[model samples]
Target: QQQVKQSPQSLIVQKGGISIINCAYENTAFDYFPWYQQFPGKGPALLIAIRPDVSEKKEGRFTISFNKSAKQFSLHIMDSQPGDSATYFCAATKGYSGAGSYQLTFGKGTKLSVIP
Candidate 1:
């Protein structure tokens, strides 16, 4: 299965608190891990990503912790802010999918709310 399912669907956290969302997949062929952040109706934007080769990857207040054997990954937002309130999605692809017929498959989606 190429499907990646995300959990919680929605979350509410106070500002400056940590926000976490999780995802799991059944596909073992996937090699790339990506997390996206969306504000609204627009498309999701790449937030942080890791590869099966790496255990964890982080950028600024965002982080992606991955486990290849477990076929699981998660996104962590540190000191989350109200601006961070949006939708987050976890995605998986066969590494670069080489841009032709195949594209990244995304999770259903998870909306997060950061209260001030």
Candidate 2:
């Protein structure tokens, strides 16, 4: 069974609209959750992250709502802009691991487009 599941595979939002995506995880050991955003011909980079200990986290135009009890999390894009168009990925892993030894497990990815 897949450890993580994300849906809608793709999304479209007009500039200034809100964009949302969701995910679920089966591993309770995964205490760290992160969302990555990627543009075409580029690598995915960290956008926002939350820990099981926290219920929510926000950074600029991105927000992450985490439901620890349900083992789920979701991302919300506020004040969406055309530049926000990219692929988004939800990932989870242990919060603390040895240096240079941490790795992330990612969802297939959701492609988001913000029309200008």
Candidate 3:
């Protein structure tokens, strides 16, 4: 299990703009970082992720930036759209399968609103 810290209780972005979310973890044991997007009445779905060794990772319009020394990471959503509006959560885990505990601790989500 890993503890996570996230910010921006909420956000509002214009259509075609960029959406940003940030998270941090103090536990060096955490090796995997992932962001999840959730819609109303639906389970959170994996959006993007990055490893501590990777400085940055991008997929489509989503990007993840990781800073190992600072134990911090952030998510950037480019070309924001109305469909992209949702609650975003940042999570961290140790990626241990042979352990007694395997869980992902998430932070208070950032509610992003993209204006049309």
- Tens digit per residue, CA lDDT, model 3, 1-83: 44687889899999999988889888888878889999999999999888788899999999999999999999999999999
Alpha-carbon lDDT, every model: 0.89, 0.89, 0.89
Off by over 4 Å in 3: 96-100
TM-score of each: 0.92, 0.92, 0.92
Off by over 4 Å in 1: 97-100
Q: Give the deviation of candidate 3 from the true structure as CA RMSD.
A: 2.0
**For residue 53, what is the lDDT in candidate 2?**
81
RMSD of each: 1.8, 1.8, 2.0
lDDT of 2 by residue, 51-113 (tens): 888898988889999998899999999999999999999998874554434578889899999
Model 3, total clashes? 0
lDDT of 1 by residue, 1-116 (tens): 54899998999999999999999998888878889889988888988888888898889999888988889999999999999999999988885656544578999899999999
Clash-forming residue pairs, model 1 = none
Provide the lowest-lDDT 10-residue window in model 1: 94-103
